[model samples]
Target: MWLLFLLVAAVAAVFSCARVCRAAVAAARTGRPARPPAPAPAPDPAGDDGHAPGLTLYEMAYLSGGPQRLADVVLVLMAQKRRLLLAHTGWATVVEPVAQDPVERATLSAIGPDGQRPIPAVREALVADEAVRAVADKLVADGLALPAAARPGIRSGIRQVWAAALLVVLTAAAAYWMAPPGTDTALLLGWFSLPLVLCLGTLAVARFELHPYRDWATDEGEQRLPGKADPPGSRLPSAPLAPLTSLISLALHGPSALTDPALRAALHSSGA
Candidate 1:
């Protein structure tokens, strides 16, 4: 009966909205930053510790910005260091053949085998690169980031609600059209409205974190994200902010944090 179908749709919507709300709560739980730790002991000489004492620039970027932001951080730093040439017009050229780290190597590799590619192309390529994914995987392994499978996508969640709404509408229409004479189809329609009301209420109450932050870092991890930025009016060449340390600023504030006009223009245009 149409009433039954409406009830089923209502249940489906409730489940979907519940899932979305749970994700939002989980994100909120992880949204708090971890407290700063006491002084650390001497470093392990064999390079066996998983993550370094505090946090690496790569890890910081991953925590604050997710994969795409991490990639953008690397590209902007490389351009600042002159390891690569990134033009405001959206082209990238590899200036230095050697990469200092895995993340840099990944960026360079994403530029393609020929060492040249459009800035946007390279940005996209680097985001999906295995190397970048590896960084996210490591964070997840350390409990700093949510795993890919568990990441909450608000759009997808809303889509499920939409499907439920559609099902309810179709069922209600069918029940009305197929009713025998004097079957009281008006009452049937009113019953169906209950499920629709349920769906609408679920949507009204649900909440989720915005993208990237919720997509990546856990509460503990978010706590570790750097709160500093380059002091205003700071410029490059003198390296007012060390290049590696500066990645923190770039990660936190994005391309606008870069003191170099050309670097900001290039990466910003690349959709970083």
Candidate 2:
């Protein structure tokens, strides 16, 4: 029984590791770029029934500086007078009088076609207007209202976690099926999985670390390690030998060797 369990775990570990390794290789080649978030869709002011022509939720948000924009979107529900108050058109519509400062409320009022007033009514009117609806629809179709960029690291991290989990479950199951129940195979499988898991984790970390400041089209992650900047000129030695040469130069002369006349002359004449 133990032997069977270990065998199953081993098999699971192998497959999981293989899948993650392939993904890591692919990610390396692409030089992970941050994914751009899709823009929020404008709401249909014509209402949910589609009977009226109006702005969609997204369009209304844009005009009111409300939703759609990450900065403007509030997760918390706004309330007043111990009752939930919803914003209509662009104004806060409350059943009870607001106890909050009058000055603050006045400042938040929306300006509409008629004049400056509460926002809820104006928001509703625009959303219900046929022109707003058409514009909102067009905006979504044109793809002009993109939200924001999402970090590639996050996606990579998620993938890594998923891969690791799958590998663990498979390894455990394989070990159980392959080995006798009362054997040492479970321990063996556990030990084997440690190294495999570590390798996958390391690769995930490496990919994320290298993603930023990396030009995927040209430079691979391995080539862009610390101090891998291009040489300033041909006269300059290769990167690895650079520090030693600098030390030698400094030892022979001093820090001023960097600014020496002879060095400058040589550099200028070298076409570097």
Q: Write the per-residue lDDT of candidate 1 for residues 147-190, one digit (tens) a residue.
A: 66556555467567667777778888888887778878778888
Candidate 1 wrongly placed segments (more than 4 Å): 1-5, 18-53, 152-155, 162-214, 228-239, 242-246, 256-259
Best by TM-score: 1
Best by lDDT: 1
Worst 10 residues of 2 by lDDT: 69-78
Q: Model 2 residue 262 lDDT?
A: 40
Indicate the TM-score of model 1.
0.66
The residue-level lDDT of candidate 1 at 143 comes to 64
Residue-pair clashes, model 2: 46
Error of 1 at 161 (Å): 2.4
Error of 2 at 26 (Å): 3.3
TM-score of each: 0.66, 0.27
Q: Candidate 1, overall lDDT?
A: 0.67
Q: For residues 1-272, what per-residue lDDT tens digits would candidate 2 score against the true structure?
A: 44454454455555555655555454444433233323443442111212112323223233223122201111001121222233322333344333232222322232322334343343444334444344433433333222112224334444555665566566666655676556676476676567467545655664665343121111322231222232322233446654333322322222233333443332223221
